[model samples]
Structure formats: structure tokens, C-alpha cells
Target: MSTFPDYYALLGVSKTATTDEIRQAYKKESLRTHPDRLTKATVEERKVATEKFQAVADAYYVLSDPSRRSEYDILYRTKAGNKSSDPGSSQNFFSQFANMFAGASTGAGTGAGPHGAMPGHQPDANGVFADVFEELLRPEVERVVPWWSYLGAACGAGLGFIIANIPGVMVGAYAGNRLGAIRDAKGKSVAVVFLSLGGSQKAAILRALALKVLGSAGM
Candidate 1:
């Protein structure tokens, strides 16, 4: 059996909570646990807060997405009464997601220095690029691509017919179909990773990337 987070508990919401309620709970929890709110705290305290914030963000991300939430609900129901006796079960689950974020954070903080020491806190280009790519492609990776694939083939054929003739149209359709199938397969692979994640971790990355994407668009 795959392990999963109790997102509802993480967000301090009941299973029956409405979307708005969940959003409210997330906002409250996020603010309360945000690392910035612990400026005076010791390093360990701040670390704990950061982890809590990530978990809250992860919970919100899953619970807010209707389809993902539905999948989670099914799994949650299946595991509902089967409480583990191990005290570390929840911590283990959170750590799986946290480790991903922690690595990203560490890389970003340390920057691209060979010794993990940079003069200023420069952004790690590779780490940032990887996170951005993962977050941006996540939705596409979750999308159903069959209809889009057919559409791509049709569009390709039409364009080819205009440019060349029947031969071009046939070539274009084949190329487009292959491209679509490639994308579909890529999405399936990413979807498998999503399931392996136990249904969390993209939201914090999305939030970070959204600022960059939206900032560029505005400028």
C-alpha cells in the first residue's frame, strides 16, 4: 500500500470542508507557520516552521485541485480506518515531500559555487531552472492529450496542404501524430512521478515560479 499525507489534517480542515474553508485554513496555517514569521527563532525552530509551511502548502495544493482532490479522497477513504501504530508514520510521509523541497532550497541558497560558498546569496541557475521547468510542465504532464493530439494532426495536415500538396499533408499528419504521442508519453511518465510523490509537493514550486512568470509578463 502506498503511503499518503492526511491533507485535511495538515490544513486543519475536516474532510467535509468546502473549498473556501480549505483555502481559509491554508491561509491561516501558512501565515502562522511561515518562516519569515520566526525571525527571532533559533535555526532549528525556523527549520521546523519551514517544514510545517511546506506541508501546509502541499496540503492546499492537493485539496484545491478538484481532480487531484478526488483521487486523494478515494485513497483517504481507503486508508481511513487503518491507522498505523508507528509514531513516525506522518513524519515519514512529510519528510518524503520535504526532502525534495529541502534539496531545492539548499541548492538555491548555496548558489553555483564549487565549494557551496558564494559571496552573495546568488540563485543556483540549474536548480532554479529545474524547479521552474518541473512546475511549468506539471499541468501539461497531468493533461489528457489524445484529443489534442488529433487536433495537432489535423492542423498540421491543413498547414501542409497549403504549403505543399497531398504528400506534405501526409507527412505533416504523421509528424504531428508522433509529436503528440511523444508528449502523451512524457505526461504519463510525469504522472507516475506524481503518484509516487504520494500526491503532494508542486504547490510551493508553483508559487515561486508564478512570481517569475507573472513578473516577466507584467514587464
Candidate 2:
């Protein structure tokens, strides 16, 4: 089992809160904890306020992202015993996955029939699995290249131009771009795995496996 910060509680929102609701809660909490508002307070008060402000910002950062929020919800449910007590075990985790798949299928087939299938229709297990897998793997928000990458490229090119002119400029630009791309890829992969696994003791092993898979696929 793993313990995680209660981000929802930190933002003063419920687990089922809508995105707009969460945004509003974050705005309220952030304003209350903003360090500038405590300028005349004691040193200790300012320090505490700063910490709370950062925590609120962190809570908003995680909760505002759909993909990360989904992952957090899984861990939250596990921690709250909404899921099985020992979700860290491979067997238990797979069982939960299967249950989720089944539930999805059931929900999709609602009002179809007592047998949970539409008239003259057979459920496509493979198709359903593929959809679920795709959803799990997809990032809810597409990320743009980091601003620092452009800055790095400009700096590298300038330095190279100063040293060796034309050919050096090309080489420097390529190196900078390659480095940035690699760093970005690794960062995204790690973020996905960390949020999905929730940093549990057993989850470390799973995270390693996930990273290996992503790496092998050149993610």
C-alpha cells in the first residue's frame, strides 16, 4: 500500500468535483495562502503560508490535468479502500483491471438485454480491450515543446557560431534539438508512470516495467 497527499482535501473539493469547481477551489485556497497576503506577519507565519501556497499550487497542478487526475483517482480509491485493500499485488491489480473492463462492457450494454448484449449482437472482447488500452495509454492533454528547448538551441547556435561559424552552428543546433527531445521524452514517460503507479512500494517494480516498455518503443 502507498500513502498519497489528499489533493482534493487540500483544495477543499470533493473527489467527484467538476473541473470548474476544482478551479474555483484552487483560486480560493491559493488566495488565502498567498505569501504576499502575509507580508506583515511573523517570519514563521510567512514560512507556513509559503508552504501552504506551494501545496495548493501542487494540488491544482495535479488535479487540473485530466490524465494525471485519473491516475490520482485510482490511488485515492485504493487508499480509501474503495478498491481492494492490497492493490499493489499483481494478481489483485489484474483482477481489478478485469473488473473495470467488465463494468465498462456492462455499462455500454445497458438496456440492451438481460444477457448484457444487444439483440443479434456479440460483444467484441478484443475491440473493447483495445479501446480501454488506448484510453489508458493516451495523454489527455497534448504537450508542446518546452520553452527552454528553443532557448537552448539559440544559445548553442550562438556559441558555436562564435567558435567555428557555419558548420559548427548546424552541429550545435542539431545537438541541442536532440538533447531537448530526449529529455522531453524521458520526462513525459516518467510523469506518466509516476502518476499511474502512485509511488507505492510494489509500484516501483511496475513503474520500472512501464519505463522499460516505453523506452523499448522509443516513447
Best by the lDDT measure: 1
List pairs with backbone clashes in candidate 2: none
lDDT by residue (tens digit), candidate 1, 77-178: 878765342323445554443332222322321222231213222222223223324445466434433555787788889878988899989988888877
Q: Indicate the residue-level lDDT of 157 in model 1.
A: 93
TM-score of each: 0.39, 0.37
Candidate 1 similarity to native, TM-score:
0.39
Worst 10 residues of 2 by lDDT: 123-132
Flag regions of model 2 displaced more than 4 Å: 1-3, 81-219
Q: Give Cα-based local distance difference scores for all models.
A: 0.52, 0.48
Evaluate model 2: give its TM-score.
0.37
